[model samples]
Target: MSVHETPRRPLRVSFEFFPPKTEAMEETLWSSVEKLAPLRPDFVSVTYGAGGSTRERTHRTVARLVSETDLPVAAHLTTVDATRAEVDDVLEEYWQAGVRHIVALRGDPPGGLGEAYAPHPGGYANAAELTAGAKARHDFEVTVGCYPEKHPESPHFEADIEMLKRKVDAGASRAITQFFYDNDVYERYLERVRAAGIDIPIVPGIMPVTNYKSLMRMAGLCGASIPRRVARLFENLDGDPATRQLVAATVAADQCLDLAERGVGEFHFYTLNRAEMAYALCHMLGVRPT
Candidate 1:
């Protein structure tokens, strides 16, 4: 629709940010968080790096947000290289720090995405285990990841849904999907999920594509598809960063509005620790700063 014609239904949004490695990056992340805070997202989440590499940074960032912002913050906790005790200790720390929500994950290998994934010698086996452990440790509201296109390791979609079912049974309250380009893909996945009787909220993960080449590489690693039209939108703007970002914002905003038409109320944005695009998206969706 037009800029003035927002979706009539109310929308719920959340943004994801990664822990920063440098002082400058941390400043940028905090600025973005500050800018978006007034819009009042459903919750804001900080990502844990692969294999718990950013455990301390993630904790520090979440604690700061809890202390400084009124926003409800969700800390990401992963089952990767750490032992069960180590992971449980982090859970206690989060609870003590006033974090009530967790994004439990089975992270990639310590070696990175291309490397083979293995549980630690004594760690939780997967996200389901982590979810159960998180709930048992502190009664945190747990959210787990779901792959609408099926996880790269899963042999089929059924297997993926079964894994999600296990997470739900383990007390996860919701699932956030991997970023998807096609709304039809999300709808089909939702249909299948309902058919299988897994009814938890599956919030769509929205990623604004500002850099075409970077997105292609990331999408390849994560098994997210790139539609040709999306590629075409960024085709000749590689040298024009400003124009490309505008296109990115428009493309993602259109996707979100379209999703609103399809009965989706909740959206989780992968902010890449930047606010402009995500802010633009919310504005377009009629979420004004309050």
Candidate 2:
């Protein structure tokens, strides 16, 4: 008898976290990190707040991760409300702090989404320029964001693909997509990206839906659409945290398994500084601790 192997590549997962604002939240973040670290993620990224609002907090969290853990940490850099020199200094700081990977972004304006983005007088205009600048500064492995449903500011998906190609040309080693629920949407976007001749690992961003209202809000801002069927799954679980957690895990697991069966090997999860759900999802996906 012939033996058929799994026919799937080993799944590689990474996570994204935001720097905490208070002592309690900081503890929670570290606890989550400790809990998820055992699954052996490829890396964990720390996010910068809008317009560099969480600049110092992000730096401190990243630096602490460098000092305290054996896990690889990626510092997020943004060209929002900061000059070229300012951003350069932050990059240098990350280097000195033992962070060699960066997730470069053209951050949202301080006034928030829908507000016009104005590049600082002496700063990089967008993620592509920021990627180039980081490459020039150091041999950092830079990753940039792409949107599967098209960026809110982008005129269309074609333009978004063109901009993504520019980022790759500028020096991005990989592109991690914005959080998306629809695997078909991601597959279609991948086809376009490949057709456009952009060759780089495009990791799907996964956001587990623990809070329905918050997820809807974020989906609106990032241009990710939630399917009506999935919406109906969370219809009556609003007040039950226990039931919501189960639904969230089941939905995320189904999504990941579908992508895996489609030959997707890498996943970048937006953990939202919570570990239980993400850890549960990883466990469900067979990413158990070594």
Candidate 3:
């Protein structure tokens, strides 16, 4: 009999969630949380809406997660709409609410991505400043956003790398990259970041494509290129929701396996308020429920 060996340990996982707007959505979000909690992710994050529109709801969710669950919560904060002091105050509030980690970002403009990003008059101009301010006010474990395929606003890849270095220098303990479909894109970006001497962990972010049309719209806004192959996978699946989900899980599972073979062990998943897909991928990566 031949024995197949298991990986050394399950990849460290984290989940990202957006504050729910409706009662039904909130129920779904908590249900998903309950389902995945047994896996014991490194941390879970709740996203603040653009321009801090969901600031209160985000706070409520993070606070509740801390109080009601055993999970550590990372609050997503941005420096795009408010003044420096205003944003800093919010960071302080998160600390008071028992949130010890934060995902700092130079948020999308109120007009959304693709539009010009004009910093508010008194705001920290970018993510780096937000990271520094958060660290200064408290000993928060700060995670900043990164883009593997280059931020759309950046003029070139080199410029994007320089910006990432700046964030690292400004006390970002780690970076969670924007999700991409191609493993090669992430590998190349990681190489470039390492070559630039930025030593912080750059955790890959993965988004399972449950809804092809919606995913494409989001990818377009975020500048993630959807390959023709990906499109073909969902082309004839409009009438087959179950198969589409299975395919989505398979694709993401393959992406993680490729990363793991290269020694990547940390993963951040954009859960979209759902658990089955992320949970299934993590299970395949050797994450067992505790």
* lDDT scores of the candidates, listed in order: 0.88, 0.89, 0.88
Candidate 3 — what's its lDDT?
A: 0.88
| Winner by lDDT | 2
TM-scores vs. true structure, each candidate: 0.95, 0.95, 0.95
Model 3 lowest lDDT segment of ten: 1-10
lDDT of 3 by residue, 199-264 (tens): 888888998888898888878888898888778878988789999988988888888888888778
Segments in model 1 whose C-alpha atoms lie over 4 Å from true places: 1-9
Better of 1 and 2 by lDDT: 2
Better of 2 and 3 by lDDT: 2
Q: Cα miss at 46, model 2 (Å)? A: 0.5
Cα lDDT of candidate 2 equals 0.89
Report the lDDT of model 2 for residue 151. Answer: 96
